[model samples]
Target: MSLKYLKIMEEIKLGLATGSLIAGGKLPSVRRLSQHFSCSKNTVIKAYSELEKEHLIYSVPKSGYYVVAEFQHRTNENEVIDFLSAGPDKNVMPYLEFQHCINQAIEHYKEELFTYSDQQGSYSLRVQLVKHLQNLQVFTQAERLVVVSGSQQALHLLVSMPFPNGKNNILIEQPTYFGFIESLTLHQATAFGIELSMKGIDLDRLEYIFRNNDIKFFYIIPRFHNPLGHCYTNFEKKKIVELAEKYDVYIVEDDFLGDLDPDAKSDPLFSFNPSGRVIYIKSFSKIFLPGLRIAAVVLPSLMNSNFLRYKFSSDFNSSALSQGALEIYLKSGMFTSHLKKIKEVYHTKMQTLVEACDSLLPAHTHFSKPTSGFYLSISLPEHVTAKQIVHMLNEQHIYVDDASRFFLPEYKRDTLLRLSISQVNTNTIKRGIEQLAQCITLIDDRNDDRKNHPIPNNLFLL
Candidate 1:
């Protein structure tokens, strides 16, 4: 191959690495890219054609070329660690026990698993969930439970379910879970966001949203919320339950990380509202494996008919095989045992991350110590942008969720970054933190320079 061809191939590789061409992402047309790069169409064609032949890219007749899959290459320890992306700490996952349970479920329940299970989910899993919720002090019955594929699906179904037309508004925390926002958007529901604080949802803002809008439902993650690892206090939970009662608004409490708490004794919002006004949704993915895609929503007795209808319409049911396996896993006492192990692992990882941040990060940068769950949000200086920080981290092969993405368009705050400890090991955690510190310091330095040497009017013209 000529040097020109080699350079084109290098550019393709770099594009994939930098996510200029993401997985399942379509590449620009050869002619378009050729013109942009000021290169011949044949050169662009040669590179793409070569990649296609190698099965790295695939093309459709009318559609364009797309990256099919990532090619894994062997590398050293640091390179391997870099490849592992500085996101959640995967080392804490209970892979062995989970795999064992899955294998056993498949082997023993092959025939039953192949068929469609109940729309409400496997009876046994529902029973298990009832027990799990009771253990968490949120009392509920099996009849009140419905299983969805994941928390995302649960949110989708909840948002889509018909409510009184006049009371169609939904209340969500500003900068809350992105999936919840997407769900509300898809359902075409009007959602008003309540501002959040370190103490959890701002009660004043909650009341304001409720009083100002005809909110039929309120969605909240009262325990270790995504983007912000703020857990609701027992007092706050009681106050929230009171507000819901006062307004006659159903609170959709996403207790996605309820089981993963290190304390294991924190009270959920649902515990306060036993009258079925509060719908509690929980996920098994973060604590277990993401592929499990198992989530349960505890519905009020009155909503049972609506929920059943919704579940029937939405994919008919959750995965029967996975539900069956989870049921067996729960019955065998393996689930709890594995959870206990994960708690210890995650607790230790959280501590390590906190320690690393304390030592490496600037004192001005602040973060809350997460009591449970896989993530915590770090607050940067006011002038710093989360997007810029994420970009800097990505250049070093580290990935993090920008906190701005979690907020509504009107609530764009640039000073926070959500760091997840679910996909990295202890060693990688240390390294990732060091790199993050470096990135932040670099940004701070640049800001200082800009402040000291303001841009001239002539530069603005360019």
Candidate 2:
């Protein structure tokens, strides 16, 4: 056997000694063990067979392997918890109902589901989406709607389809969504970053980029913008629309998290620009259930023909069954009820995070109070990089998004971190924040000590 296989067997032996792999307990399949050891099935089988011969384990026909005898002691516990990413809390998901919906959709729409759907999405779903948009005060006719896999795909399609040539550039807010930057880069399109303030994107920098570049489109997440969690002011929204019109630049408005806004009074960019210049995208994933993976884009009537063609070439269509189930969910008013439940839960969670930040974070560390959204971005001391903080926190099993990932390579802003409040409850938020605070304090103290006492090269020479 190879040294590597021997090493894996040794580890397995240690696991057995420590009672980590309990007796009478089923071991992972040969394929799984092979993957874990980065070895072949034969190698794993050899090891298992050796163990079995030694009377350590027994294999049953068809059922595979199991431990032969019980061990006396307990094993070490796994002590890792991820906090940096945001998704629906596993505890909160309505799994039973969601599963029922999925099964029903599959059984009922089996024949039709086998084929490709309409590129612009199912007609029935589009109709429901139109109504949903209308509810959000984003009025668009059914013909203008294009269903996409998710908001990410919607953004990708928009980034790819709207421009006539690859040479055309798009404008984005500095420290924007990392995924957005990735999508823009994939298209080989130049991205101009406008500096952001607490209010929103800096208008002067925005104007400069517009005047200097042959920008084809400007993408903005006006409400509860990713990372920053800053909502564009009503005046700023108007200015953005006016600027887009003046510069003759198309605006890709991502209203992905707008549904969770506590105050639904604020209007979207689409509300201002009913014309084709503003393309509005919305996602039901965050608010409802992510497994649905359903999102819609409001296309201008002028671009409908071309957009439809482009969409067809991409995915043929969104899932018909998902669309059907979503239609039922939307019409049943369960979606709205779910939204209310989510808002209530998220609102409390956001408040808890805010309070934690106030109590736990250093006086020097500063963050904005977000009116709405799942996240809050804090600006740290320039000397303290978000990457360093993330690394430190991750060692303690507390994960956080480093702000640098969101910016363009040329645009380096390291002293920022985004804290997502969506996936965790208020109770857990306290402990997570406390751990995060400890990490920050240690980093800051290390930096202070470094400043006080610099290492001398002469010591190395001596």
Candidate 3:
């Protein structure tokens, strides 16, 4: 399908954003827009019609279209600078395009959607996934891929299931994805932690842990790690996989944000050991539609049956409708186009965030400098806690995450803060950092004051 109309829609949206097109302002006539864009009148009409459907604009009986008056109110900002939300940017989400896909899917698979589906997910969707995985350097066939509700479900299942290695414990990075930590807690599984920083983990420590710990599998987010946004180098990934093989330990590679990696030369851990020492999990939640709850996991063929049994107990199958719609979206090449657009958008946003941090943060503060990812972490000064910063920022309607929950109990620290670039307005990033720097300085000063002037022990008695 031609995306010329989408371009037209984007131009109008940009106008609205920049105040060039005010609420209730009359829009250019169909003929004028067609002449300006050098497109057909029907194309202009279609663009306007779509905007009208979205309630961004309306048409009179005989007059030109006008922006919806209430649109101004919706777009008006109350000065909320959000760094907590980790979802895709609301402005760029292809909701309308996917809505079309949903309609097409219902018409194509109306009979199959409501009934029970294959416990391993739809075969047709898996085929499309096979093709999609190739883009991420994960070479696998549909036979080895299992579609799940999401990557979280896959991680939860792996945490509880018995691995082929027969080892009982799980090993993870010290500060990892919180959802996975929650799974470990609920299952009461024995887990070991390896410290990770922007520089990556210590290979010697990892080898020692792998050899000593009765580790079943190492759960790793190889790209754009949650909270830390730390991505491993190709050499590190290859070594990790080799060590896992040498130790008879399995590797669960969660490449959730791999699609957004700017390094085309970088390969997933699965690519290093395609014969199945590594299990690859890809999540669509970060870069694509999250509400669909769709993810694909490439498992070792030997473990597929056992994994399916566990999946069967969780839910009969993932949403068949979601699978069907995603298949069409992939087959139609919409997903590829969407990826191209978002890749640049996120890369630019991440750069902006890092630049702001470098210029605005205090000298005592340290932060990760990821090339392109949704998160950038800040290490606060000693005696300055993430809770203090989070609470202070909340008063100003600025939001950020406390990274304490991301750590295992034994490795917990209170001075780490995570700032997500996904949902924050790109224009407001510098301002948010400015406020955050002030908060950190205030708390650091208070700590200094307390040390210099201690209250006397007898003051309370008096």
Best by lDDT: 3
List the candidates' TM-scores in order: 0.78, 0.79, 0.92
Question: Which pairs clash in the backbone of model 3?
Answer: none
State the C-alpha lDDT per candidate: 0.77, 0.77, 0.91
lDDT of 3 at 197: 90
Better of 1 and 3 by lDDT: 3
lDDT of 1: 0.77
Estimate the Cα RMSD of every predicted model relative to the unseen true structure: 13.4, 11.8, 2.7
Writing each residue's lDDT as its tens digit, candidate 3 over 384-427 gives 99999999999988999999999998999999999998888777
Tens digits of per-residue lDDT for model 2, 215-253: 888888888778888888778888888888777788889
Worst 10 residues of 2 by lDDT: 72-81
- Per-residue lDDT value at 95 in model 3: 75
Error of 1 at 16 (Å): 28
By the TM-score metric, which is better: model 2 or model 3? 3
